[model samples]
Target: MVSPDVFYGALTRASGRWPLSAAARELVRSGVPVFPCVPGGKRPLTEHGFHDAATDPDQVEAWWGQHPGANIGVPTGAPSGFVAVDVDVHGPVDGFRGFSRASRAGLAEGWQFLVTTPSGGMHAYYPATPGQEQRSWQAARAGIDFRGDGGYILVPPSEVSTTGAVAGYRLQRFNAGASSVLDSDRLRDFLDPRPAPRPPENPGLQRQADMSRLAVWVAARGEGERNRGLFWAACRLAENGVPASDALDGLSAAASDAGLGEREITATVHSAYRAAHPTREDSASPTVRDSSPAAPDDWFARDPVSRPSSVRGLG
Candidate 1:
């Protein structure tokens, strides 16, 4: 039931003093629950984070009073009746390009509000349908992510540390007087596109079993080891004739289990596949020979007696 007039009025009134406490107050007055974040950072001042967002004038006043220069955070999804499609420009893939691709594919043709992040990324705001439960998620193999239920986005005029990667958030496209809502279904379809169906299973390939093992191996990798593990696994899968897309699907699941971030996992898996299958015919292919310690004719076999017993354990 929220109207754009309230937001536009607030924006006009707070135009001159951006990133100031008064601007955040004006946003709150528009019925958008807001919370204070640490100046120049996304970290919330409240202990419970976005859950502490409030529209109450007294609470907002107290929060801004405590931290005069705090940044503003608006919870997305049901809390604010909107979902934010976040395009990360700093990620390995070009987010804006991906979004453009989606748009060209007719997946993103709805009216929406747009905010440009300081990092040169973007947030596309869409009105959430009542009773629609959407969760934050990263689009597979893309630099895009969603901030929906249980998520939050920093509003425009909120400053991020210029010294760091992100710059700040700024209003980009705001239809001042119109209350046009974004098409939720279209946005969801764009963000979470279904994978094309694969051909009938081939019994001879033992593809399912191989993929299962690869998933388990990927899931076992620790933080520092995730990239290398996923890359090696992907290469091995490719060597076994598994399609790159299928391998990526399994690898993504495993990477998620290993607590690796979406961006890192996608980049690593893609890099590995690309390495295994050279894009150019003249490009050097990845070496996939078995180099385990147990393999015969290895370094251990070169000088079994002369080499130290402890050194034999090296792979």
Candidate 2:
């Protein structure tokens, strides 16, 4: 894999007044796989999205030859040998403050390069740990996203045109100091801290706290795992002695935010409840595949009464 510094250098050379096709070719030549995105936008132009990213010069040439204006998209983490901390800047949802807090906590330094995104946001680049698997996650409420494994980011010079206005990503700063691999887990915890479930003398307070954290976890789940995550969280609540109704109520809005419908959320919660307490009294057993006995150490696994929970981010 190409080093982060080499990747950043290639990107810098390709950016600024270079044709989009030239930029795409430059990256593939550096052993960085890249794909074409919609002209002036972030949407993937290919059928399989970032999965179609390729390092082959001919493949990249064919792609850009067809759409010269397409923006360059590179998969993060293992595929590109780098990860990104995306600080978003949508209206009323600036992430700089949270990023600043992370930096103060000494969790946001060691970035290889800082790129200014089209929307006036920031994408801080960091080298991927050589053999570690860091998955992607979004702390939407925090207005930040970690583009690690299973995620992609538009490289410098990619433009976004909205309402006839066009803006491009630009390399703003390069860190000449030693670049370090980011501990995505630590950064996430610092950005959106959740209390570890504990045995409480105040049971009511404990339930509320656990449910809140679980709901936040559900809310943060990304596509392809929303339903499964909700089920796991609901099951955690059930295993912790919380009622089914409360689980539904606690996780409803969060599930909704994660793009699950009312019915799906309701069904998943009920299924989880049944799975947690499979009694003959349950007239109809849940048949959903998610209800199939999850191992104690599955994604977002926890034994609230015995130990701390370990939540997995999207991958």
Candidate 3:
């Protein structure tokens, strides 16, 4: 498989209008297998979808000749030497935020270029690991999808007809940094993490496992209640003897999935634990014994005056 950098270099150098037929042939000549999708759409024109991708020049010529305007489909992962992190923008969900979170976590990076999809989404192409097989996955809630092994992507110069307008996939930008293989597994985990493992034999861990529902509830918390909800849930765990660190471990990812920032999640969990078990300095208990006195010297014992003498005007 040719590196994406090399593939892209040759692809851009090919001169022409890059019409469907010409672009298909050019991809074949550049050593990337190609397939046809329905004209102005994503559904495969061939019977087997991406499995029909071929590098043979004659097959390429025949397919494009028959369907002159079929969109170009390139198999990702090993077949094309690259995988894509697809950022979907739909309704009220903007995947760019989730992608940003992944990038901050050092998961999604080193892409060849960003392809603007017809529906205004983005496809970030990254080099695939040579020997490793990274399967594709979709985090629907996060609005991000991975196109790796067993998946395909529509490349540049392919147009999709939406409503009434014809919008084409275009190169948004090229990455100047060193392009490296993305860890798709890690990226998926960061975006939409799985639930904690089943209950373990250890009693403490077993108890923690039983509280996984709390984490799920926290993740489902919406805008106004996210922080307060997480704090309340964490407090329940802490009050039941769940360690602060364990609470952090269990709730951090869930709270993050619910749209809480890392720092806010940490602080909230710690706050819950603190609230569950207040510190000596924050305790409100009386320092002296309750039975010690109610005498003049025991003014301290007189129900601990609700107001200072000066405020009460007691001379």
User: Every model's Cα RMSD, please?
Assistant: 15.7, 6.9, 20.9
For residues 221-246, write the lDDT of model 2, one tens digit per residue. 76765886788788777765666777
Q: Which candidate's TM-score is highest? A: 2
**Candidate 1 TM-score versus the reference:** 0.62
TM-score for each prediction? Answer: 0.62, 0.78, 0.64
Candidates 2 and 3: which is better by TM-score?
Answer: 2
What is the lDDT of every predicted structure here?
0.66, 0.80, 0.75
lDDT of 3 by residue, 226-314 (tens): 78668767766655555567678888899999999998887777766666556523322212222322222211111100111221211
Q: In angstroms, how far off is 19's CA in candidate 1?
A: 5.4
Which ranking of candidates, highest TM-score first?
A: 2, 3, 1
Expressed as tens digits, the lDDT of each residue in 41-76 for candidate 1 is 899888778877788988888888989988889888
Question: How high is the lDDT of residue 301 in model 1?
Answer: 16
By lDDT: ranked, best first: 2, 3, 1
CA deviation > 4 Å runs, candidate 2: 195-198, 202-209, 212-232, 238-250, 253-259, 266-315
